[model samples]
Target chain A: MSRITECFNNLKSQGRKALIPYVTAGDPDPKITLPLMHALVESGADIIELGIPFSDPMADGPVIQLACERALLHGTRLVDVLDMVAEFRKTNQTTPVVLMGYLNPIEIMGYSAFADKAKAVGLDGVLTVDLPPEEAGEFNRLMKASDIDVIYLLAPTTEEARVQKICAAGSGYVYYVSVKGVTGSASLNVAEVAEKLKMIRKYTEMPVGVGFGIRDDASARAVSEVADGVIVGSVLVNKIAELTGNQEQIPEAVAAITASMRQAMDK
Target chain B: MPTKEDLAIAKQMPDAGGHFGQFGGRYVSETLMAALQQLEQTYEKLWRDPQFQAEFDYDLAHYVGRPSPLYHAERLSRELGGAQIYLKREDLNHTGAHKVNNTIGQALLAKFTGKPRVSAETGAGQHGVATATVAARLGLECTVYMGEDDIRRQALNVYRMKLLGAEVVSVTSGTRTLKDAMNEAMRDWVTNVDNTFYIIGTAAGPHPYPKLVRDFQSIIGREARQQCLAQTGKLPDALVACVGGGSNAIGLFHPFIEDADVRMIGVEAGGYGIETGQHAAPLSSHCKPGVLHGNRTCLMSDEGGQVIGTHSVSAGLDYPGVGPEHSYLQEIGRAEYTAINDDEALHAFRHLTLTEGIMPALESSHAVAEAMKMAPTMDKDQIILVNLSGRGDKDIHTVAGIDGINF
Candidate 1:
């Protein structure tokens, strides 16, 4: 089994929802990323979603788009992101890490080569924001061949038929964007998310993680009740943006948000 | 890996799944897949419906003033002293450009699909004006997203859109250009997909957009073809048009794709020059293939696959990616792509204005510049047809600024 599946299965046995915290690799600075990954793991994060920054992140709102700008300012390439994952694996190997970003980078670096490098670096999963199942046949085949889980996102607007199609194509877990807007948009309605999750569960057995509007511990706790995982972005990236000049405090400052969410989720 | 046999049937492109030989597909977030599927289905059904076709044709005739004149530039051709030159006067359209052809169709699609609101993205503001004009005629709420930079550069057109009742939202992210404006428009569509219809201005973006836009804009080539045959007794030896997101080029080239003897030429903006690495000529510069704005296409990107900044005096031609069908056409050797520097385009702008008493848009001047170069090399009996996709009335301020004259 993939590391993502194993981690989720372990979390299920303990009756706990998974906590996934996303951070753009090389944001603020590249040196802070490895320490930040370890900090997120230390703060009760079950999985880390490392963002591979692209020039135009259309699916994202302003907060994460700024994060990408900060990351790209330092010239963070996909190869550098893989190296960071490889470095993190040297000390902490149990926590699953998923590389999340757009598809152009992987397209430039050939899908087969990226899959090989991702597997070699101990990466657990991939979630390309814009690559839906309709265009992910070759990408999925390559990742599956390399033993990497390919996660897919389901929006609130996604109908039942496509939900089944995406679920069958995806492995490890399903990411449900809890709102119709881009990441870092307005507040999400837990009841609406619950309705969508209920429909999604009828399609696949994969652990369903809800994201895109979970801003705080209260929202995280609410989502944890209906989802198998609570995925938070933007809010944490906002924290990093706040401490951009004082880069040393970023790891702890960003981790504290996840720590509080983890505490709320566990309770 | 399409065989030569496959290339022969390239006119029947964008297969059922929207792949144009691994170039065009719906590479968008899952949130948009269903909407695109619905759009594809609706377009396929309505495209064949006689009522829909009749309404579209009626608008083209009465509203947009279709069959825009094909004028022989006798003075300019005599000066070039090599080939006869003809201009397909898309500049004479109701809104002073070819952009309205696709916007009119999409706005009608909006009316047919029961969508009450329409959104669009623009660079040069021609598409914004065209879309806003259609929405006003149809009584639909309209919003246009434009980059902050373009809003400042093309302020006149921005005001024109507002005069037509569009709410122009200024995008201030990611280099603040057309691609960023497109990103914001896509986000708006994703957020409001239920009651809103996105009127894509170019022959780019995801699956149904390129195909539908091409189908609507093909009226350019259809009319030009019949006009050439009726007036000159033969098809023009070549068709030339400027390509940014490639709507106008595809419009003038689609109907002529199967004309084996007629060559198709697309001109990309060479800002300073291609070797200066400051231009937007992706195909001419032999850029790599990557995905951007929802489709796989030839892109001006860095080694890391990040889209790089592009420079052009004409806002309409300053984009980092071209339409995917252009890529497929270039791949199969069915069409040739070239570049026109900013200076050459400006020269052509002045030359056409003086000789033919017609001022072409800066974007269309790129095509005019290439035709000037080609016309001088061909025999006098041979003919070149240029799609003058827009008028230069909107570009008066830009030209004045370049000439150091206060408008």
Candidate 2:
């Protein structure tokens, strides 16, 4: 089984929800991402989502958009991000790392070469924000060959027919974007998200991880009630934004919020 | 030059799934899939419906002004001393540009689909003005998302939008340009899926949009074809139009796709020049097949796939990506794409103003520049038709500022 699937299955057997904390790979500073990844695991994060910064992040709101700008300011490319992941794998192998970003970078690298490179770097999964299942053929083929999970997103407006198609294309787990709007833009309607997940569960046995707008500890716990994994992005990335120049405070500041959400999810 | 068969394969494309030979597809956030699918269905159904066609046709005729005259630029042609040049005066439209064509159709679609509000993104503000105009006519609430940079650049148009009762939103996002404005517009549409309809300004974006915008704007090419036959007693040897997101160019080229004898050229804003690495000509230079702003098209992005900033003298041509259909056309050899730098476009702008007494928008000036280049090389018997996509009134300030003139 893939690393992401194995991690999820292990967490399932333990009767525990998965905590996924997302941080842009080179945000604030290039050196802080590795420390943030380690600190996420230290704070009870089962999986780490590393953002590959792009110049234009359409699916994201202002906070994550700013995070992308901060990362791009460091001139960190896809290769540098993979190197960071490889560095993280030297110390920790149990926590699955998902590279999340837009598809342009991978397209530039060519799908086959990117999949191979990502595998060599020990990336567990990929979640391209813009690549839906309809256009993810070569991306999925290459990723499947490399034993990397091809994660898909399920949104509030994804109907039954498309849900089945998306779920069928996806492996590892499905990321359910709880808001209809972009990341960091809206409030999560947990009851509505729960209802959608109930229907999404009909399409696939893969675990559903809820993300987008899960800002606070209470919101994380609320989402964890229905989701197998709670993925928080803008909130943690904002911590790095707040303490950008202070490298010492950046990881701990991000981890403190993540740890609190983890504690809330556990309850 | 592509044969009829080679061109036919590309011309008939965006098959049911909106795939233009592995180029175009629905690559938006998953939440928009069902809504987009619904829009596709509604558009497809209304495309053939006689009433819908009548409504669209009526607007094209009366509301937006149809059959914008094809003028023979005799003085300019004589000056160039080569091919006889003709200008399809889309500049003479009601909103002083070809943008109203797509906006009217989309506003009608919004009316048909029961959307209460219409939102659009604009870089040049022409599309925003067109949308606001149509929304006022149709009594639909209108909002236009323009990049903060664009709002500063085109302050007059921003005020015009406000005067037309549109809530002009300044999108303070990445690069603060057309691409970011579009990103913000898409986000807004996603947020208000039930009541809002996003009228994409150009022939880029996701499925059905490129197709729909092409269908609506094809009136330019359709009329130009008849005008060429009527006035010149034969078809033009070549057609040229400026491409930003490629709507105006595609509009003038679509009807001629099957005409093997008529060469098509798309002019992209070279900004400074391609060699300087500071232009918006994706098809002409720095092009790769990547998904951006809803469709997989020729995008100007870095090695890491991040979309890079595109520079253009014209706000209308300042986009990092072109339409999928244009990419298909360029790839299949049905059409040729080349860049005209800021200096050449400005030269053409002044040449047309002096010789023909017609001032062209900077975006349209690129086409004029290319046409002038090719016209000088062709026989007088050969005709070159250029789609004068917009008027220059809005750009006079820009031109004046560049010339260091106060007024």
Candidate 3:
């Protein structure tokens, strides 16, 4: 079984929703990111999504976009991101690390090279926001060959046929964008998300991870009831931004949010 | 010397590995390779389909106001010199720009493909308005991603799109401009490829889009050729059009590309100058042969391949890249390109408004400026046909604000 699948099954067996904390890799600082990743896992993160900084991140909200800009200002690239992941794997290998970002950097690097490098570095999956299932054939094939899952996102606007296509192409838990807008636009309609999740469940047995605007504990808990995983991104990135100039406070903020979210889900 | 038949054969032949001369070829992620191949095949099949052609022709004629007038700018021509200058009035088309001509065709194609929603990125809101106009007409859900800055500056157009029932998404990432909007649109297309159709506004992007958009837009050149022949008894001495992503220019230039007697000039936006790093003249300055947004074209990039920002008084022309076919035309010496700074374009904007009583878009003003410069140099009997790609209604506020006046 894939590590993501294993993680999902373990969480299911324990009757717990997966706590996925998204952090921009090399944000705050590269020296601090790996430690933060470890800290996130210790703070009850079931899965960790490492956002690779991109020059033009279109799907991201302002918070994550600013985080990406800060990371790139420090000269962060795909190689630097993978090296961090590889280093993180030295001590913690069980947590599934999904590299999420746009497709340009990976395209520039070549898919086969990226797949091999990612697998070698203990990365389990990739979530390319801009690569739909219809276009992801070659990338998915290469990653599948290297035992790297290609996670796909299904938006609220996605139709039944598209959901089926995404389910067939994807291996790890499918990410469901809760809103029609960019990452941190507004609060999501929990009932609407639930309806979409119910529709998604009809097509795929793979766990669905709901994200995009699930900021607070209430929203997270609302999503956790229906989704197998609740992916928190903009909120965490915003927390990092608030602690910018003061590096010592990042962990406390991240831990506090993660704990709050974990407690909400457990309720 | 090549025979007519031989030239036709050459035109039909896909350049070494499916390029349009040196301009077009697939430079995309391996993830997109299969879909692009499929799209290329589908486009080829549709290109030969009689039904598709008939429908496209019908829409171009009725919906988009085909055979848009070829009006002689008598006053402006006389002012520039004794040279006779004509304007191919693409602005008179429905939705007030040449962008509608291509969008109408692509929206029909989207319907044929069974796509429920149409997605696109717009720079000046002209393309967005055009796309929204067609989506409303065709009953397809339309989503147009635009730069956040553009959304604020082009508020009237934003409202126009909203009124047309199309969602205008503000893309705040990456310089908050045309290139970023294009990036967002591409991401949306990638994310929704199964059920969405991307109606690209320019003759750029991947192979099939460049070819498809040009084919649709070529109506401008084709109509101008017939109109010129009927009116002047021969083709004009020169064809002048502005190059944003080179859509309007390519549309006017394609039919006359083989006419040896007719010279072609592509005017680029020079915001200040090439040296100031505040210009959108990618073809004239700050660009090298590179792959960006799925097309191997002239792009403004740093040494490390990071795409750079471009500036122009014209929001539509503020792009860091030019179309691949324009690059090829420049390389093969079939066309000449020149830069027109903001001041020159503004002068032409005012000149056209006062002299011709036709306010052209800042993008179209670049071509008008080039025509103003070229007319004086030409012989008294020489005629210049300029593709007035869009009306200046969207630019009035900006022009007024810049001059510290209001209309």
Candidate 4:
């Protein structure tokens, strides 16, 4: 089984929801990423989603978009992101690390090359924001061949027919975008998300992790109740942006939010 | 006689899945897939409906003042001293451009679908004014996303959109140009997919958009085809149009796709020059294929497939990618693409105004410049039909700024 599946299984056995925190690799600077990854694991993160920054992040809101801008300023490339993941793997092995971003960088590196490099780095899974299942057949096959989970996103606007299609295409877990807007755009209603998750459950047995608009501990805990995992992004990236000048405090500052959310979910 | 393959190439494009021979497909986020699918279904049903066709045609005739004249520019033709030049006066449309044709069609789609709001992205402000005009006509709320740089260059059109009661959003993201504006528009559509209908101004973007916008804008070709036959007793030797996102070019080329003898030429913006790498001539420069703004096409991207900034004297043409259909056509050798630098396009802008007393838009000026170059090398008996896609009024400020004039 993939590390992602194993991680989810272990969490299920422990009766605890997965706390996933996403941070852009090479944000503020490249050197801050390793410490941040270690900090996230220490803060009780079950899965760590590392972002590969692209020039244009169309689906992201201002927070994550600025994070991309910061990462790109440090001249972060797709290869650099993989190196960060490999470095993270050197010290930690249990915490599943997923690379999430847009598709252009992977396309530039060629799908086969990207899949091979990702496998070599021991990356757990991938979640390309703009790559829908309709265009992900070959990409998914390539990742699956390398024993990497190809994660997909389900949105509130997704119909039931597509929900089944996406679930079948995806592995590891399904990322359910809790709102209709881009990342960090609007607040999500837990009741609405619960209803959507129920609809998603009818199609597949895969764990559904709810993301988008999960900012504070309250939203994270609320989502954790309905979802198998609470995926938080913008708020964590915002922390990095806040500590741009004082790069030393970024890891601790961001981990504090994750720790609080983890504590809230455990309660 | 055209071969079966040639005819097939023209008719069977952008297959049901929206792939224009591996060039165009929906590469948007999962949040937008269902909305795109819904849009595709609605567009397919309405496109074949006779009532919808009649209503669209009626609006084209009455509101937009269709059948824009195909005038033989005898003076300019004589000046060029080779092929007789004809101008398809799309500049004479209600909004002073070819963009209104597609906007009117999309606006009706929004009305039929009961969408209360319409969102659009514009580069040159021609599409913004056109979209705002249609939205005002239908009492729908309209929002147009434009790059901050474009707002500065085309202030008059921005004011025109505001006068039409449309909210103009200044996009200040990466490279703040047409590409960024499109990204912002896509973001808006993803957020408000339920009640909002995004009226894409060009024959670019993902699936139904390119096909539907092409269908709507093809009126230009249909009219010009009949007009040329009626006036000259034969089809023109060449058809030229400026390709920003390729809406105007596709609009004028779709009807003539099967005319194997008629040369279709698309002019891309060569900002400084192609050799300088400061241009937006992706097809002309032979850039690699990459996905952008929901479609795969030739793009001005770095080695990492990150889209780089594109430069052009014409705001409409300052885009990183061309329409996927254009890419497909280029690959199959059905059409050819070339570039015209800023100075050359400006020369054409002045030359045409002096010779014919008609001011062409800077985007259209690229086509005018290419047509001038081609016209001089062809026989006088041959005809070159250039799509005068828009009027030059909006570009006066840009041109004046270039001339070191403030006003």
Candidate 1, overall lDDT?
0.94
* Residue pair clashes in candidate 4: none
- DockQ of structure 2: 0.80
Quality class of the docking in candidate 3, CAPRI style: incorrect
Error of 2 at A72 (Å): 0.2
Model 4 spans > 4 angstroms off: B1-3
Q: Write the per-residue lDDT of candidate 3 for residues B1-407, one digit (tens) a residue.
A: 44455445434634534576645666543334445666677777887999999998988888877879999998888878867999999999998999998898888788778889999999999999999998998899999999998887788899999999999999878789999999788767655666788899999987788888888899999999999999989889999999989999988988877786688899999989878988888788736665567666777765434567888888899888888888877776677888999999999999999998999999999999989988998887899999999999999889878979965
Per-residue error for B132 in candidate 3, Å, reads 2.3
Q: For model 2, how does the per-residue alpha-carbon lDDT over A84-111 read when each residue is reduced to its tens digit?
A: 9999999998889999998888888899
Model 3 Cα lDDT, one tens digit per residue, A1-267 = 988999999999999999999999889787778888888988889899999887766566678878988887887788888999999899997899999987667766778889989989999999987666544668888999999988888876566876887799999889988876667877889999889888999999999998888889999998999889999998988889988898877877787899889998998
Per-model DockQ against the true two-chain complex: 0.84, 0.80, 0.11, 0.82
Q: Any residue pairs clashing in model 1, and if so which?
A: none
Error of 1 at B294 (Å): 0.8
Candidate 1 lDDT, B286-312, residue by residue in tens: 999999999999999888889999999
Q: What value does the lDDT take at residue B27 in candidate 4?
A: 92
Best by lDDT: 1
Assess every candidate by TM-score. Answer: 0.99, 0.98, 0.72, 0.99
Off by over 4 Å in 3: A1-23, A34-52, A59-64, A73-246, A249-267, B1-10, B13-43, B187-195
Leading candidate by DockQ = 1
Off by over 4 Å in 1: B1-8
